[model samples]
Target: MEKFEQIFKYVNEYAEKLVEANGLDYLEALLQTLEDTLDGTFEWQVEGANKEDMRKAIQIAILKGMRKSAQPNHQMTPDTLGLLVAHFVEQCFEHRLQHGPIAVVDPALGTGNLLFTVMNALNGNVEATGVEVDDLLIRLAAATGDLIEQPVTLFRQDALEKLLVDPVDAVICDLPVGYYPNEEVALDFELCASEGMSYAHHLFIEQSMNYTKDGGFAFFLIPANLFESEQAKQLHKFIKGHAWIQAVIQLPENLFASKAHEKSILILQKHSEHLKAPREVLLAKVPNMSNREALAMFFEKVSMWREGNDQKR
Candidate 1:
């Protein structure tokens, strides 16, 4: 086995032992054990190994364990797509890094995979925070934060009802893809009645906007029905009124490699009175390609569009 794989195996075994002894959750045990083991140069067989790098790899191991145990309803974004979303955020907000650390939030932070990648892409030029309604996922996110040595504040609260004390620089997430189970929770959303089949994604999008500063960005991975169904027209109108739709990229079916459903990434900038909304939005359909190739193409086209070049396809 590869050296990193060896590290993962050892870490998993240690975490499992901790779970058995202390009756702790898998993620909690994994993180507690890893903190002791990953102090400095670890897995030296891997060239130029550092503590943080090893921690990142171990975090992935914990993520895999979580994914394996995840219920079908969890709706976690695949790691590759999470990386793509992070890349998009980094590219779009790279200029803001010069001013100060950009504050970013994921209202539906599942395992914090999206935040982790975004932090890496922006070279730590971010103050990352998230809210997760799931106890398991929130604990997992906290553990992942410890493993990666990334300081992320995660709140265990309903994303829709959570109040934002301060507006942030950007809001990004793979919005949960189903109806809110609790009607009381659903009632608080702006378009609760007209959100059609699923209110989670739309409501979270609205909540994200609420916490975003004027001229700040919000990105979401949502079902394609959001752009199709007649019920969503109101939501679209609301979006147009409140923000500028920067780009809508129709992702390939099976982009997540399971269920084979078509989804789109909506990149929106909250409207500011000082700046007029663009006359036209960039719309592109991503072709089937390896994740690396697809994300590279995406970043390239978006960079061009932001530079005032009209990007076609």
Candidate 2:
């Protein structure tokens, strides 16, 4: 980890130097530096050291440093929550081998942590794409992809304005928190007719659902109080009409580095006439412990539920 930090620091310094010397854009300089140094910076001659290990190290190190230096986006999913969300996605694909090599998209992919984690959990058998409004975060995410030799298409467009032409297998995101001040952007009138547009997170969740194919999943880490908020009643009503609620996992408070608000991961499957919706949704709460025990327990519970479903079929 220490070595990784050193490498990341060197890369940062190199990018800054390039910016100063060439008068290049920050993102362009960083991209150039990453392309030139990724191979040499992580070269490890130690026995059993492989490109995969180097790639993981580079991703973690750069992500840690970038998070520290870059302007904070409270909307970004915390690492722990992101990992758990990724695991849930992997579980969704466990029994569906026919869809083995699925597509996962993150509409608000800050640093691409959740997106890449999902790819890793699936053992690199999936295609990953992300759309981020922030240039710096997207650059760092692209650099990580370059290092790992993994292809992840990142669009610079705002997620609110961009709609997917081709639906995907899963829509996974840690929605941007707080209200979206833009009232001009057209939204589902039903979501706004009752309470008007309140939070941007609500719109993002809707976008996630819309991005998924029939019978596909959309997972979001959102404010735990969302369900109780008066402004969200319309959002819930809209969801009831269009999607099947699958699971709601409450996360521990302070799981995020920026905010301590209690959060939850909501899993929804887009409305599908051919696939029957679950009679009862899974609602699980994780204890506030930082250990991996809580995640293991959650995984076990989900596995049991899935197995029961298989038996019924």
* Candidate that would win on TM-score: 1
Clashes per candidate (backbone, < 3 Å): 0, 0
TM-score of each: 0.83, 0.82
Cα deviation at 114, candidate 1, in Å, is 0.7
Please write out the lDDT profile of model 2 over residues 210-313, one tens digit for every residue: 78898899998888788877776778887898898888988776565454476788999898877777766888887766567866786789888666553122
- lDDT (Cα atoms) of all candidates against the true structure: 0.72, 0.71
Tens digit of per-residue lDDT, candidate 1, span 30-60? 6566555556523224555553455456656
Model 1 has an lDDT value of: 0.72
Summed over model 1, clashes come to: 0
